[model samples]
Target: MNLRTFTAVLFALTLPAPPAVAEVGLSPFAGFRMSSSVDIETAGASADDQIHFRDSPSQGLALNFDLAEPGKQGELYFSRQSTSARLDNGLFAPGIESIDLTIYQLQFGGLYFPGGKSYGGFVSGVLGVTRLEPEDSRYDSHHRAALSLGGGYQFFLTEQLRLRLDLRGVYTALNSGGSVFCSGGCELRFRSDGYLQVEAGAGFVMRF
Candidate 1:
Protein backbone atom coordinates (compact mmCIF):
# COMPACT_ATOMS: atom_id res chain seq x y z
CA MET A 1 0.00 0.00 0.00
CA ASN A 2 1.12 3.59 -0.58
CA LEU A 3 2.27 5.69 2.40
CA ARG A 4 -0.60 8.23 1.95
CA THR A 5 -3.26 5.45 1.88
CA PHE A 6 -1.86 3.86 5.08
CA THR A 7 -1.86 7.27 6.84
CA ALA A 8 -5.52 7.90 5.80
CA VAL A 9 -6.60 4.49 7.18
CA LEU A 10 -4.88 5.12 10.51
CA PHE A 11 -6.55 8.55 10.88
CA ALA A 12 -10.01 7.06 10.15
CA LEU A 13 -9.56 4.36 12.81
CA THR A 14 -8.61 6.93 15.50
CA LEU A 15 -11.75 9.08 14.97
CA PRO A 16 -14.57 8.61 17.54
CA ALA A 17 -17.85 6.93 16.56
CA PRO A 18 -21.05 8.93 16.56
CA PRO A 19 -23.39 8.79 19.56
CA ALA A 20 -26.49 6.56 19.43
CA VAL A 21 -29.87 8.21 19.03
CA ALA A 22 -32.62 7.62 21.60
CA GLU A 23 -35.53 5.50 20.45
CA VAL A 24 -39.17 5.27 21.51
CA GLY A 25 -40.22 2.80 24.17
CA LEU A 26 -43.22 0.84 25.33
CA SER A 27 -43.99 0.09 28.96
CA PRO A 28 -46.59 -2.23 30.42
CA PHE A 29 -47.44 -2.16 34.11
CA ALA A 30 -49.69 -3.71 36.76
CA GLY A 31 -50.72 -2.38 40.16
CA PHE A 32 -53.42 -2.02 42.80
CA ARG A 33 -55.99 0.85 42.92
CA MET A 34 -58.38 2.16 45.53
CA SER A 35 -61.36 4.37 44.74
CA SER A 36 -63.44 6.59 46.99
CA SER A 37 -67.17 6.38 47.55
CA VAL A 38 -69.57 8.19 45.25
CA ASP A 39 -72.92 9.67 46.02
CA ILE A 40 -75.98 8.70 43.97
CA GLU A 41 -78.80 11.20 44.17
CA THR A 42 -82.35 10.92 42.96
CA ALA A 43 -84.75 13.77 42.36
CA GLY A 44 -87.71 13.95 44.72
CA ALA A 45 -86.09 11.41 47.04
CA SER A 46 -85.80 12.06 50.77
CA ALA A 47 -82.09 11.31 50.89
CA ASP A 48 -79.13 10.38 48.73
CA ASP A 49 -77.67 6.90 48.34
CA GLN A 50 -73.96 6.26 48.66
CA ILE A 51 -72.16 3.60 46.69
CA HIS A 52 -69.03 2.40 48.41
CA PHE A 53 -66.38 0.85 46.23
CA ARG A 54 -63.98 -1.57 47.79
CA ASP A 55 -60.23 -1.37 47.27
CA SER A 56 -59.27 -3.50 44.32
CA PRO A 57 -56.50 -4.34 41.88
CA SER A 58 -55.79 -2.60 38.60
CA GLN A 59 -53.67 -3.21 35.47
CA GLY A 60 -52.55 -1.06 32.57
CA LEU A 61 -50.18 -0.52 29.66
CA ALA A 62 -48.49 2.60 28.32
CA LEU A 63 -46.66 3.78 25.22
CA ASN A 64 -43.89 6.31 25.58
CA PHE A 65 -42.64 8.48 22.73
CA ASP A 66 -40.33 11.42 22.40
CA LEU A 67 -41.63 14.94 22.73
CA ALA A 68 -39.99 18.06 21.34
CA GLU A 69 -37.29 17.96 24.00
CA PRO A 70 -35.21 15.41 25.77
CA GLY A 71 -36.33 14.01 29.18
CA LYS A 72 -39.97 14.59 28.24
CA GLN A 73 -42.29 11.91 26.94
CA GLY A 74 -45.79 11.71 25.51
CA GLU A 75 -47.76 8.80 26.80
CA LEU A 76 -50.86 6.90 25.75
CA TYR A 77 -52.27 4.65 28.42
CA PHE A 78 -55.24 2.47 29.38
CA SER A 79 -56.20 1.08 32.77
CA ARG A 80 -58.98 -0.97 34.34
CA GLN A 81 -60.12 -1.86 37.84
CA SER A 82 -62.93 -3.93 39.31
CA THR A 83 -64.48 -3.45 42.73
CA SER A 84 -67.54 -4.54 44.66
CA ALA A 85 -70.17 -1.91 45.35
CA ARG A 86 -72.35 -1.87 48.44
CA LEU A 87 -75.42 0.27 48.95
CA ASP A 88 -74.96 2.35 52.08
CA ASN A 89 -78.60 3.24 52.61
CA GLY A 90 -80.98 1.67 55.05
CA LEU A 91 -83.53 0.97 52.32
CA PHE A 92 -81.67 -2.11 51.19
CA ALA A 93 -81.80 -5.18 53.39
CA PRO A 94 -78.67 -6.40 55.09
CA GLY A 95 -76.58 -9.02 53.33
CA ILE A 96 -77.95 -7.97 49.96
CA GLU A 97 -75.93 -9.01 46.98
CA SER A 98 -73.09 -6.57 46.32
CA ILE A 99 -72.97 -5.11 42.83
CA ASP A 100 -69.80 -5.29 40.79
CA LEU A 101 -68.44 -1.99 39.53
CA THR A 102 -65.79 -1.96 36.84
CA ILE A 103 -63.96 1.21 35.87
CA TYR A 104 -61.84 1.70 32.79
CA GLN A 105 -60.13 4.59 31.04
CA LEU A 106 -58.00 5.47 27.99
CA GLN A 107 -55.94 8.60 28.26
CA PHE A 108 -53.20 10.65 26.57
CA GLY A 109 -50.80 12.86 28.39
CA GLY A 110 -47.25 14.09 28.72
CA LEU A 111 -44.78 13.22 31.46
CA TYR A 112 -41.85 15.30 32.53
CA PHE A 113 -38.79 14.24 34.49
CA PRO A 114 -36.94 17.03 36.26
CA GLY A 115 -33.86 15.09 37.30
CA GLY A 116 -32.88 14.11 33.77
CA LYS A 117 -33.85 10.41 33.77
CA SER A 118 -32.72 7.52 35.97
CA TYR A 119 -34.73 8.21 39.15
CA GLY A 120 -37.10 11.20 39.21
CA GLY A 121 -40.64 12.49 39.69
CA PHE A 122 -43.19 13.10 36.97
CA VAL A 123 -46.53 14.87 36.64
CA SER A 124 -49.24 14.48 34.04
CA GLY A 125 -52.83 15.35 33.16
CA VAL A 126 -55.24 13.10 31.32
CA LEU A 127 -58.62 13.49 29.65
CA GLY A 128 -60.71 10.49 28.70
CA VAL A 129 -63.92 8.56 29.19
CA THR A 130 -64.66 6.57 32.31
CA ARG A 131 -67.05 3.64 32.16
CA LEU A 132 -68.91 2.27 35.13
CA GLU A 133 -70.22 -1.25 34.72
CA PRO A 134 -72.87 -2.67 36.99
CA GLU A 135 -73.46 -6.37 37.43
CA ASP A 136 -77.22 -6.09 37.75
CA SER A 137 -79.07 -7.12 34.63
CA ARG A 138 -81.83 -4.54 35.04
CA TYR A 139 -79.57 -1.51 35.14
CA ASP A 140 -77.43 -0.66 32.14
CA SER A 141 -73.82 0.49 32.33
CA HIS A 142 -72.94 4.19 32.23
CA HIS A 143 -70.09 6.18 30.67
CA ARG A 144 -69.02 9.72 31.30
CA ALA A 145 -66.30 12.24 30.63
CA ALA A 146 -63.35 11.91 32.94
CA LEU A 147 -60.30 13.95 33.84
CA SER A 148 -57.30 13.12 35.97
CA LEU A 149 -54.26 14.80 37.53
CA GLY A 150 -51.44 12.61 38.68
CA GLY A 151 -47.85 12.61 39.89
CA GLY A 152 -45.45 9.81 40.61
CA TYR A 153 -41.91 8.67 41.12
CA GLN A 154 -39.96 6.10 39.15
CA PHE A 155 -36.91 4.12 40.21
CA PHE A 156 -34.78 2.36 37.65
CA LEU A 157 -34.08 -1.22 38.60
CA THR A 158 -32.29 -2.01 35.35
CA GLU A 159 -31.90 -0.58 31.89
CA GLN A 160 -35.30 -1.91 30.80
CA LEU A 161 -37.08 -2.27 34.14
CA ARG A 162 -38.48 0.26 36.63
CA LEU A 163 -40.50 0.48 39.82
CA ARG A 164 -43.13 3.19 40.01
CA LEU A 165 -45.40 4.67 42.66
CA ASP A 166 -48.30 6.87 41.61
CA LEU A 167 -51.06 8.94 43.17
CA ARG A 168 -53.91 10.33 41.12
CA GLY A 169 -57.27 12.00 41.46
CA VAL A 170 -59.92 11.12 38.89
CA TYR A 171 -63.09 13.10 38.37
CA THR A 172 -66.09 11.74 36.46
CA ALA A 173 -69.39 13.38 35.67
CA LEU A 174 -72.45 11.16 35.72
CA ASN A 175 -75.87 12.37 34.68
CA SER A 176 -78.65 9.89 34.05
CA GLY A 177 -81.93 11.55 33.16
CA GLY A 178 -84.06 8.50 33.67
CA SER A 179 -86.58 7.18 36.12
CA VAL A 180 -86.75 3.98 38.05
CA PHE A 181 -89.82 2.55 39.73
CA CYS A 182 -89.75 1.14 43.23
CA SER A 183 -91.71 -1.96 44.27
CA GLY A 184 -94.68 0.18 45.33
CA GLY A 185 -94.94 2.03 41.97
CA CYS A 186 -93.01 5.05 43.23
CA GLU A 187 -90.81 6.71 40.64
CA LEU A 188 -87.26 7.87 41.35
CA ARG A 189 -85.58 10.27 38.95
CA PHE A 190 -81.84 10.14 38.49
CA ARG A 191 -79.84 13.35 38.78
CA SER A 192 -76.40 14.57 37.89
CA ASP A 193 -73.65 13.35 40.18
CA GLY A 194 -69.92 13.79 40.32
CA TYR A 195 -67.52 11.04 41.30
CA LEU A 196 -64.09 11.76 42.75
CA GLN A 197 -61.79 8.79 42.86
CA VAL A 198 -58.39 8.74 44.52
CA GLU A 199 -55.93 6.08 43.54
CA ALA A 200 -52.53 5.17 44.99
CA GLY A 201 -50.52 2.20 43.91
CA ALA A 202 -47.10 0.77 43.12
CA GLY A 203 -46.31 -0.95 39.84
CA PHE A 204 -43.59 -2.76 38.02
CA VAL A 205 -42.80 -1.22 34.64
CA MET A 206 -41.09 -3.08 31.83
CA ARG A 207 -39.74 -1.12 28.91
CA PHE A 208 -39.07 -2.29 25.38
Candidate 2:
Protein backbone atom coordinates (compact mmCIF):
# COMPACT_ATOMS: atom_id res chain seq x y z
CA MET A 1 0.00 0.00 0.00
CA ASN A 2 1.00 3.62 -0.46
CA LEU A 3 2.18 5.71 2.46
CA ARG A 4 -0.99 7.72 2.81
CA THR A 5 -3.23 4.71 2.59
CA PHE A 6 -1.15 2.78 5.11
CA THR A 7 -1.09 5.65 7.55
CA ALA A 8 -4.82 6.10 7.29
CA VAL A 9 -5.42 2.46 8.01
CA LEU A 10 -3.10 2.58 10.98
CA PHE A 11 -4.85 5.54 12.51
CA ALA A 12 -8.26 4.10 11.97
CA LEU A 13 -7.26 0.86 13.57
CA THR A 14 -5.93 2.75 16.60
CA LEU A 15 -8.88 4.93 17.37
CA PRO A 16 -10.13 4.80 20.95
CA ALA A 17 -13.34 3.13 22.01
CA PRO A 18 -16.28 5.16 23.30
CA PRO A 19 -16.49 5.64 27.04
CA ALA A 20 -19.01 3.60 29.04
CA VAL A 21 -20.00 6.22 31.60
CA ALA A 22 -19.19 9.66 32.97
CA GLU A 23 -16.91 9.29 35.95
CA VAL A 24 -13.38 10.29 36.98
CA GLY A 25 -10.60 8.56 38.88
CA LEU A 26 -6.86 8.95 39.35
CA SER A 27 -4.26 6.24 38.82
CA PRO A 28 -0.48 5.97 38.66
CA PHE A 29 1.22 3.73 36.12
CA ALA A 30 4.68 2.56 35.07
CA GLY A 31 5.96 0.57 32.11
CA PHE A 32 8.87 -0.32 29.84
CA ARG A 33 9.30 0.28 26.10
CA MET A 34 11.67 -0.81 23.36
CA SER A 35 12.39 1.08 20.14
CA SER A 36 11.80 -0.57 16.80
CA SER A 37 13.49 2.21 14.82
CA VAL A 38 15.78 5.19 15.24
CA ASP A 39 14.39 8.26 17.00
CA ILE A 40 16.05 10.57 14.46
CA GLU A 41 16.24 9.69 10.81
CA THR A 42 19.40 10.64 8.97
CA ALA A 43 19.25 13.45 6.43
CA GLY A 44 19.41 11.17 3.40
CA ALA A 45 18.23 7.77 4.49
CA SER A 46 15.10 5.95 5.54
CA ALA A 47 14.79 4.47 9.03
CA ASP A 48 14.83 1.02 7.44
CA ASP A 49 18.23 1.73 5.82
CA GLN A 50 20.14 3.27 8.72
CA ILE A 51 22.41 1.63 11.24
CA HIS A 52 24.61 2.42 14.29
CA PHE A 53 22.08 4.55 16.17
CA ARG A 54 21.54 3.59 19.77
CA ASP A 55 18.29 1.82 20.61
CA SER A 56 16.30 2.41 23.74
CA PRO A 57 14.73 0.02 26.26
CA SER A 58 13.23 2.35 28.77
CA GLN A 59 11.21 2.63 31.97
CA GLY A 60 8.31 5.06 32.28
CA LEU A 61 5.89 6.58 34.78
CA ALA A 62 2.44 8.08 34.24
CA LEU A 63 -0.50 9.63 36.03
CA ASN A 64 -3.91 9.02 34.52
CA PHE A 65 -7.32 10.54 35.11
CA ASP A 66 -10.04 8.33 33.74
CA LEU A 67 -13.50 9.76 33.13
CA ALA A 68 -16.53 7.65 32.42
CA GLU A 69 -19.58 6.01 33.94
CA PRO A 70 -19.56 2.84 36.02
CA GLY A 71 -20.34 -0.78 35.03
CA LYS A 72 -21.21 -0.28 31.38
CA GLN A 73 -19.16 0.55 28.28
CA GLY A 74 -15.61 1.95 28.59
CA GLU A 75 -13.70 4.81 30.20
CA LEU A 76 -11.60 7.61 28.75
CA TYR A 77 -8.42 8.74 30.42
CA PHE A 78 -6.00 11.65 30.32
CA SER A 79 -2.49 10.57 31.08
CA ARG A 80 1.18 11.54 30.83
CA GLN A 81 4.09 9.15 30.58
CA SER A 82 7.83 9.96 30.77
CA THR A 83 10.77 7.89 29.59
CA SER A 84 14.39 8.43 28.55
CA ALA A 85 17.11 6.78 26.54
CA ARG A 86 20.88 6.97 26.03
CA LEU A 87 22.26 6.16 22.60
CA ASP A 88 25.27 3.85 22.46
CA ASN A 89 27.46 3.74 19.34
CA GLY A 90 28.95 0.46 20.64
CA LEU A 91 32.47 0.88 19.25
CA PHE A 92 34.28 3.07 21.75
CA ALA A 93 33.34 6.01 19.60
CA PRO A 94 33.91 9.18 21.53
CA GLY A 95 31.36 11.50 19.98
CA ILE A 96 28.21 9.44 19.30
CA GLU A 97 27.97 7.10 22.24
CA SER A 98 25.01 8.60 24.06
CA ILE A 99 21.97 10.81 23.58
CA ASP A 100 19.49 11.12 26.40
CA LEU A 101 15.77 11.46 25.75
CA THR A 102 13.00 12.41 28.13
CA ILE A 103 9.63 11.99 26.43
CA TYR A 104 6.40 13.41 27.86
CA GLN A 105 2.96 12.53 26.53
CA LEU A 106 -0.62 13.62 27.23
CA GLN A 107 -3.28 11.26 26.02
CA PHE A 108 -7.10 11.40 25.95
CA GLY A 109 -8.65 8.04 25.27
CA GLY A 110 -10.51 5.14 26.76
CA LEU A 111 -10.34 1.38 27.36
CA TYR A 112 -12.88 -1.42 27.11
CA PHE A 113 -13.72 -4.63 28.90
CA PRO A 114 -15.44 -6.59 26.18
CA GLY A 115 -17.24 -9.11 28.34
CA GLY A 116 -17.35 -7.30 31.67
CA LYS A 117 -15.62 -9.89 33.79
CA SER A 118 -13.70 -9.59 37.04
CA TYR A 119 -10.39 -9.53 35.14
CA GLY A 120 -10.52 -7.60 31.88
CA GLY A 121 -8.44 -5.91 29.14
CA PHE A 122 -8.62 -2.67 27.17
CA VAL A 123 -7.25 -0.63 24.20
CA SER A 124 -6.53 3.08 23.86
CA GLY A 125 -5.05 5.87 21.74
CA VAL A 126 -3.23 9.01 22.88
CA LEU A 127 -2.19 12.19 21.12
CA GLY A 128 0.21 14.52 22.88
CA VAL A 129 3.51 16.40 22.86
CA THR A 130 6.96 14.87 23.24
CA ARG A 131 10.25 16.45 24.28
CA LEU A 132 13.59 14.96 23.39
CA GLU A 133 16.81 15.89 25.21
CA PRO A 134 19.62 15.43 22.73
CA GLU A 135 23.16 14.75 23.84
CA ASP A 136 25.36 17.81 24.32
CA SER A 137 27.46 17.20 21.22
CA ARG A 138 24.88 15.77 18.83
CA TYR A 139 21.71 17.29 17.44
CA ASP A 140 19.68 19.88 19.33
CA SER A 141 16.87 19.00 21.71
CA HIS A 142 13.36 19.09 20.33
CA HIS A 143 9.66 19.03 21.15
CA ARG A 144 6.99 17.72 18.83
CA ALA A 145 3.52 16.24 18.76
CA ALA A 146 3.28 12.49 19.14
CA LEU A 147 0.62 9.81 18.53
CA SER A 148 0.31 6.50 20.30
CA LEU A 149 -1.93 3.39 20.10
CA GLY A 150 -1.82 0.50 22.50
CA GLY A 151 -3.65 -1.70 24.97
CA GLY A 152 -3.30 -3.48 28.31
CA TYR A 153 -5.00 -5.67 30.86
CA GLN A 154 -6.02 -5.04 34.47
CA PHE A 155 -5.71 -7.59 37.21
CA PHE A 156 -7.22 -7.27 40.64
CA LEU A 157 -4.75 -8.33 43.34
CA THR A 158 -6.45 -6.89 46.38
CA GLU A 159 -9.24 -4.58 47.46
CA GLN A 160 -7.11 -1.51 46.87
CA LEU A 161 -4.59 -2.44 44.15
CA ARG A 162 -4.99 -3.55 40.57
CA LEU A 163 -2.09 -4.44 38.28
CA ARG A 164 -1.95 -3.39 34.64
CA LEU A 165 0.08 -4.31 31.56
CA ASP A 166 0.17 -1.64 28.87
CA LEU A 167 1.79 -1.35 25.47
CA ARG A 168 1.83 1.08 22.46
CA GLY A 169 3.35 2.05 19.12
CA VAL A 170 4.40 5.67 19.46
CA TYR A 171 5.09 7.97 16.50
CA THR A 172 7.19 11.15 16.72
CA ALA A 173 9.04 13.32 14.22
CA LEU A 174 12.72 13.76 13.51
CA ASN A 175 14.44 17.05 14.12
CA SER A 176 15.60 18.75 10.92
CA GLY A 177 17.53 21.73 12.28
CA GLY A 178 21.07 20.91 11.18
CA SER A 179 20.36 17.87 9.06
CA VAL A 180 23.02 17.04 6.49
CA PHE A 181 22.71 15.41 3.11
CA CYS A 182 25.04 14.31 0.31
CA SER A 183 25.26 16.68 -2.67
CA GLY A 184 22.96 14.43 -4.69
CA GLY A 185 21.16 12.61 -1.88
CA CYS A 186 17.59 13.10 -0.75
CA GLU A 187 17.10 15.46 2.22
CA LEU A 188 17.86 12.69 4.79
CA ARG A 189 14.48 12.85 6.46
CA PHE A 190 11.90 11.01 4.43
CA ARG A 191 8.22 11.80 4.22
CA SER A 192 7.78 9.09 6.86
CA ASP A 193 10.17 10.57 9.38
CA GLY A 194 9.30 9.01 12.68
CA TYR A 195 10.08 5.92 14.75
CA LEU A 196 7.94 3.13 16.19
CA GLN A 197 8.08 2.09 19.83
CA VAL A 198 6.61 -0.97 21.55
CA GLU A 199 6.35 -0.69 25.31
CA ALA A 200 5.05 -2.76 28.18
CA GLY A 201 4.81 -1.91 31.85
CA ALA A 202 3.12 -2.64 35.12
CA GLY A 203 0.93 -0.14 36.93
CA PHE A 204 -1.67 -0.08 39.65
CA VAL A 205 -5.16 1.38 39.91
CA MET A 206 -7.13 1.98 43.07
CA ARG A 207 -10.77 2.83 43.79
CA PHE A 208 -11.79 5.07 46.66
Candidate 3:
Protein backbone atom coordinates (compact mmCIF):
# COMPACT_ATOMS: atom_id res chain seq x y z
CA MET A 1 0.00 0.00 0.00
CA ASN A 2 1.00 3.64 -0.47
CA LEU A 3 1.94 6.05 2.31
CA ARG A 4 -1.51 7.63 2.44
CA THR A 5 -3.21 4.29 2.85
CA PHE A 6 -0.71 3.22 5.47
CA THR A 7 -1.20 6.45 7.42
CA ALA A 8 -4.97 6.07 7.36
CA VAL A 9 -4.64 2.59 8.75
CA LEU A 10 -2.15 3.70 11.36
CA PHE A 11 -4.46 6.47 12.53
CA ALA A 12 -7.35 4.05 12.73
CA LEU A 13 -5.38 1.67 14.90
CA THR A 14 -4.20 4.55 17.10
CA LEU A 15 -7.80 5.50 17.97
CA PRO A 16 -9.05 3.64 21.02
CA ALA A 17 -12.63 2.40 21.19
CA PRO A 18 -15.11 4.49 23.18
CA PRO A 19 -15.49 3.59 26.83
CA ALA A 20 -18.11 0.97 27.62
CA VAL A 21 -19.26 2.88 30.71
CA ALA A 22 -20.57 6.42 30.71
CA GLU A 23 -17.74 8.95 30.59
CA VAL A 24 -17.12 12.18 32.43
CA GLY A 25 -18.35 15.52 31.07
CA LEU A 26 -16.05 17.14 28.52
CA SER A 27 -15.07 20.82 28.61
CA PRO A 28 -14.02 22.60 25.45
CA PHE A 29 -11.98 25.80 25.40
CA ALA A 30 -10.22 28.27 23.10
CA GLY A 31 -7.13 30.35 23.82
CA PHE A 32 -4.09 32.23 22.48
CA ARG A 33 -0.44 31.05 22.50
CA MET A 34 3.08 32.46 22.00
CA SER A 35 6.30 30.58 21.15
CA SER A 36 9.98 31.22 20.31
CA SER A 37 12.94 29.03 19.26
CA VAL A 38 16.29 28.90 17.50
CA ASP A 39 17.23 26.97 14.37
CA ILE A 40 19.70 24.22 15.32
CA GLU A 41 20.58 23.30 11.78
CA THR A 42 19.43 24.07 8.20
CA ALA A 43 20.54 23.06 4.72
CA GLY A 44 22.57 25.13 2.24
CA ALA A 45 24.36 27.53 4.56
CA SER A 46 27.51 29.56 3.96
CA ALA A 47 30.35 29.31 6.47
CA ASP A 48 29.60 32.84 7.68
CA ASP A 49 25.82 32.62 7.14
CA GLN A 50 22.99 32.61 9.63
CA ILE A 51 19.19 32.08 9.65
CA HIS A 52 18.64 35.86 9.13
CA PHE A 53 15.96 35.74 11.79
CA ARG A 54 12.67 37.65 12.23
CA ASP A 55 10.10 38.37 14.91
CA SER A 56 7.16 35.92 14.85
CA PRO A 57 4.52 36.56 17.52
CA SER A 58 1.48 34.40 16.89
CA GLN A 59 -2.11 34.18 18.16
CA GLY A 60 -4.67 31.44 17.43
CA LEU A 61 -7.83 29.80 18.76
CA ALA A 62 -7.57 26.17 20.04
CA LEU A 63 -10.26 23.65 20.92
CA ASN A 64 -9.89 20.41 22.96
CA PHE A 65 -12.34 18.14 24.78
CA ASP A 66 -11.77 15.67 27.55
CA LEU A 67 -12.28 12.11 26.27
CA ALA A 68 -13.35 10.67 29.62
CA GLU A 69 -13.40 13.12 32.49
CA PRO A 70 -10.06 14.21 34.01
CA GLY A 71 -8.56 10.76 34.59
CA LYS A 72 -9.49 7.36 33.17
CA GLN A 73 -8.11 4.52 31.09
CA GLY A 74 -8.73 4.21 27.33
CA GLU A 75 -9.61 7.90 27.12
CA LEU A 76 -8.65 9.86 24.02
CA TYR A 77 -9.30 13.19 22.34
CA PHE A 78 -8.79 15.26 19.17
CA SER A 79 -7.71 18.88 18.89
CA ARG A 80 -7.10 21.51 16.22
CA GLN A 81 -4.36 24.11 16.86
CA SER A 82 -3.06 26.78 14.50
CA THR A 83 -0.55 29.64 14.61
CA SER A 84 1.36 32.04 12.32
CA ALA A 85 4.96 33.23 12.26
CA ARG A 86 6.52 36.60 11.43
CA LEU A 87 10.13 36.63 10.16
CA ASP A 88 12.92 39.21 10.27
CA ASN A 89 16.68 39.56 9.97
CA GLY A 90 18.52 38.74 13.23
CA LEU A 91 21.46 41.10 13.16
CA PHE A 92 23.25 41.35 9.78
CA ALA A 93 20.43 43.53 8.48
CA PRO A 94 18.62 45.80 10.95
CA GLY A 95 15.05 47.06 10.61
CA ILE A 96 14.23 44.36 7.97
CA GLU A 97 11.26 42.20 8.87
CA SER A 98 8.43 40.30 7.19
CA ILE A 99 5.32 38.33 8.06
CA ASP A 100 5.75 35.24 5.92
CA LEU A 101 5.05 31.92 7.69
CA THR A 102 1.66 30.51 8.64
CA ILE A 103 1.05 27.16 10.38
CA TYR A 104 -2.07 24.97 10.84
CA GLN A 105 -2.50 21.52 12.40
CA LEU A 106 -5.28 18.89 12.68
CA GLN A 107 -4.36 16.31 15.34
CA PHE A 108 -5.90 13.00 16.39
CA GLY A 109 -4.63 10.81 19.23
CA GLY A 110 -5.25 9.39 22.69
CA LEU A 111 -4.52 10.76 26.17
CA TYR A 112 -3.98 9.02 29.50
CA PHE A 113 -4.57 11.06 32.67
CA PRO A 114 -3.26 9.38 35.82
CA GLY A 115 -4.90 11.97 38.07
CA GLY A 116 -8.61 11.66 38.77
CA LYS A 117 -9.66 15.33 38.33
CA SER A 118 -7.73 18.07 40.11
CA TYR A 119 -4.80 18.00 37.64
CA GLY A 120 -3.43 15.71 34.91
CA GLY A 121 -0.87 15.28 32.13
CA PHE A 122 -1.27 13.85 28.58
CA VAL A 123 0.68 12.73 25.49
CA SER A 124 -0.46 12.50 21.87
CA GLY A 125 0.54 12.14 18.20
CA VAL A 126 -0.74 14.51 15.52
CA LEU A 127 -0.67 14.71 11.73
CA GLY A 128 -1.57 17.81 9.77
CA VAL A 129 -0.63 20.53 7.28
CA THR A 130 2.29 23.02 7.60
CA ARG A 131 3.47 25.84 5.40
CA LEU A 132 5.88 28.72 5.00
CA GLU A 133 5.50 31.98 3.05
CA PRO A 134 8.81 33.61 2.18
CA GLU A 135 6.67 36.44 0.96
CA ASP A 136 3.33 37.55 2.45
CA SER A 137 1.25 36.72 -0.63
CA ARG A 138 -1.33 33.95 -0.95
CA TYR A 139 -0.01 32.51 -4.20
CA ASP A 140 3.66 32.75 -3.29
CA SER A 141 3.44 30.10 -0.59
CA HIS A 142 4.92 26.65 0.12
CA HIS A 143 3.00 23.82 1.71
CA ARG A 144 3.90 20.43 3.15
CA ALA A 145 2.55 17.55 5.22
CA ALA A 146 3.74 17.70 8.83
CA LEU A 147 3.55 15.66 12.02
CA SER A 148 3.96 16.45 15.73
CA LEU A 149 4.35 14.72 19.09
CA GLY A 150 3.53 16.65 22.23
CA GLY A 151 2.29 16.60 25.82
CA GLY A 152 0.69 19.03 28.28
CA TYR A 153 -1.20 19.37 31.55
CA GLN A 154 -4.19 21.19 33.03
CA PHE A 155 -4.64 22.89 36.39
CA PHE A 156 -8.18 23.76 37.43
CA LEU A 157 -8.22 27.32 38.74
CA THR A 158 -12.02 27.25 38.99
CA GLU A 159 -14.99 25.35 37.56
CA GLN A 160 -15.09 27.67 34.57
CA LEU A 161 -11.42 28.52 34.01
CA ARG A 162 -8.14 26.58 34.01
CA LEU A 163 -4.46 26.97 33.18
CA ARG A 164 -2.91 24.84 30.40
CA LEU A 165 0.71 24.41 29.35
CA ASP A 166 1.50 22.72 25.99
CA LEU A 167 4.87 21.96 24.43
CA ARG A 168 5.23 20.48 20.91
CA GLY A 169 8.05 19.20 18.66
CA VAL A 170 7.19 20.07 15.02
CA TYR A 171 8.82 18.68 11.87
CA THR A 172 8.67 20.32 8.42
CA ALA A 173 11.02 21.51 5.69
CA LEU A 174 11.35 23.64 2.58
CA ASN A 175 9.68 22.09 -0.44
CA SER A 176 10.81 22.11 -4.05
CA GLY A 177 10.02 25.11 -6.27
CA GLY A 178 10.72 27.44 -3.30
CA SER A 179 13.97 29.36 -2.88
CA VAL A 180 15.76 31.72 -0.48
CA PHE A 181 17.86 34.76 -1.29
CA CYS A 182 20.46 36.93 0.48
CA SER A 183 21.97 40.36 -0.12
CA GLY A 184 25.38 41.96 0.81
CA GLY A 185 27.02 39.75 -1.81
CA CYS A 186 26.17 36.68 0.29
CA GLU A 187 24.95 33.52 -1.49
CA LEU A 188 22.68 31.19 0.49
CA ARG A 189 20.49 28.21 -0.31
CA PHE A 190 17.94 26.62 2.04
CA ARG A 191 16.81 23.04 1.84
CA SER A 192 13.99 21.49 3.89
CA ASP A 193 14.70 21.68 7.67
CA GLY A 194 12.70 20.72 10.74
CA TYR A 195 12.19 23.23 13.59
CA LEU A 196 11.13 23.09 17.25
CA GLN A 197 8.53 25.19 19.11
CA VAL A 198 7.54 25.58 22.77
CA GLU A 199 4.24 27.21 23.87
CA ALA A 200 2.72 28.01 27.27
CA GLY A 201 -0.64 29.69 27.93
CA ALA A 202 -4.00 29.53 29.70
CA GLY A 203 -7.51 28.59 28.62
CA PHE A 204 -11.09 29.01 29.82
CA VAL A 205 -13.45 26.09 29.28
CA MET A 206 -17.21 26.10 29.22
CA ARG A 207 -18.82 22.73 29.89
CA PHE A 208 -22.22 21.89 28.50
**How does candidate 1 score on lDDT?**
0.69
Q: How do the residues 1-208 of candidate 2 rate in per-residue lDDT, one tens digit apiece? A: 9999999999999999764532333456555655654533444443423322233345444444433433232333333334434332231123433344455555444555565432368666767766655434344455667777877777877544567778777776654443422123324342346667666666666544
Specify the highest-TM-score model's number.
Answer: 1
List the candidate 2 regions with Cα displacement exceeding 4 Å. 1-24, 39-57, 64-94, 116-119, 135-139, 174-191
lDDT of each: 0.69, 0.51, 0.46
* Residue-by-residue lDDT tens digits, candidate 3, 1-208: 9999999999999999854433333434343434443232223543322342333334444444455455533322233344333233342224544333445444444445666653468664566666554443422454556666667786666554556556656555444324443334323344335445443434543332
In what order do the candidates fall by lDDT, top score first?
1, 2, 3
Quote each prediction's TM-score.
0.75, 0.58, 0.51
lDDT of 2 at 197: 62
Model 1 alpha-carbon drift over 4 Å, by segment: 1-20, 90-96, 116-119, 176-192, 204-208
Give the per-residue lDDT of model 1 (tens digit) for 71-90: 68887878888877675763
